[model samples]
Target: MKLASFRSSIESEIRLGIIVDDVIIDMESWGIEHDLDLPSTMLEFIDLGPAAVKAVSETLKNIDARSLVATSIPLSSAIITAPIPAPRKNIFGIGLNYTEHVAESARTLDTSKELPQQCVIFSKPPTTVIGPGDSIKHNDQVTKQMDWEGELAVIMGKKATHVSKENALDYVFGYTIINDISARDCRRSGQWIVSKGQDTFAPMGPYVITTDELTDPHNLQIITKVNGVEKQNGNTKFMLFNVNDIIEDISEVISLEAGDIIATGTPAGVGAGREPQEFMWPGDVVEITIDKLGTLKNYIVKA
Candidate 1:
């Protein structure tokens, strides 16, 4: 089931809801209707684990879409917040997981720094996260070379440590879209934090799709479009290191907690890899989409 965090136009508080077709069925409302007390926030649901999802599934199956109060409110009537707005740890992201992206970055930089035997990991501060349809704040003073990297982000369901690749996927709760916006100029200065941790840099979600719905995680088609032109087009099948490997590798060092996000990595095409380099500027709309999952669109705005 697709889960979302939204606030109605008349309400000031954010509430969790289950997505049914085009409408959102508020969990609290469902609980009131059925005399059940379930979680009311996305993070709360994440903490509740399978029980929360099962409850939502059961509740949705019994309720009609027309009965939801959210039906009268258009999706745009409420703002979509990050699935886990404030995660427990820094958001981890992998670099060059796709062979083509590895090759392209290698060609652009020194070829000597090529593929590695293990995953190359980096962290994006929780402060960088923004919801879908949020504006990406482009600070022209700090960075003139702002770029985008579309990646599939995996949300952990349960706490795990020293997990094996064989069972890594079992710990996943769901998946979401993340546009890993970067500042190429800041990155060239030998620091990734400034480049990656800007406010609104991490635009994630339309909704978090449960792992059970995605039968084959590695077979999905991933695409990114800037304005209206397709920029990055690739498949998870081309990933040099698959999801299970990433989970296993990461779990070996740090304990994976529920709500912690892991961005698998981006595909070949990136603005930094293009001829003359195409960087994001004010008014640029970037749309990142993955098969089975949904689209995450954000507009770039001058800070």
Candidate 2:
């Protein structure tokens, strides 16, 4: 099921809900209807695991659309906070999982530094995460070349360590869309922290979709459009290192807890790879869509 976070108005508290068709079924309301004690905070639900998800699924199945409150809230209701508003740890992201992206990034530097036998991992601070429809703060003074990397992010369902490729996907709770926004200049400085961890750089979720509904994770199409122009387009089938390998590689080192997100990297056609280079500017709207996982759109504004 598609899960989302939304606020009715600026004065309203952020709420977690499941998106059924065009309607937002508030989790709290569902909890009240079913007599289940709902999570008071977003962080609490992240730890709720399968039981919470099952409860949500069952609740949605029983609710009648006519009986629910249909307030007609706009997509930009108030602010869409990250589905997991505050994760316990920083998010783990992979770089150059798509072969074309690897080749494009390699040309600027040494070609020898191209492909790795293993997944190249990096971390984005939890603070950088924002929800779909949120504005991406473009700090002009620090970065003139801001780019968007549309990726399919895997959300871990259970704690995992030393997981094998066969059992890696079994541990996945769901999937979501992540726009791995980057500052090209900061990234070229040898350290990725500043380039990736800027505030509001990471745009994740309109909802987290459970794995049961998404049967074939590798067969989805991923696309990114900037200001209505299609830019990045590719499928998960092209990934150099698939999802299972990534889990095995990372699990060998650090233990992945529930709610920890793993961004599986983006495809080719980044701004930096263009002929003259086309980067994000103020007022640019980036829309990222992954088949089955719904679309996530965000606007870029001057910091």
Strongest candidate by lDDT: 1
**Candidate 1, which segments miss by more than 4 Å at Cα?**
65-76, 111-113, 188-190
Tens digits of lDDT, candidate 2, 32-128: 7667888745556657887877776776678775546642343444356678866778999998788888887776523334577888889999889
Q: Which candidate comes out best when scored by TM-score? A: 1
Deviation from native of the Cα of residue 242 in model 2, angstroms: 1.6
Give the clashing pairs for model 2.
Answer: none
Query: Ten-residue segment with the worst summed lDDT in candidate 2?
Result: 70-79
Give the lDDT of residue 273 in candidate 2.
78
CA lDDT of each prediction against the hidden true structure = 0.83, 0.82
Query: What are the per-model C-alpha RMSD values against the true structure?
Result: 2.0, 2.3
lDDT of 2 at 131: 86
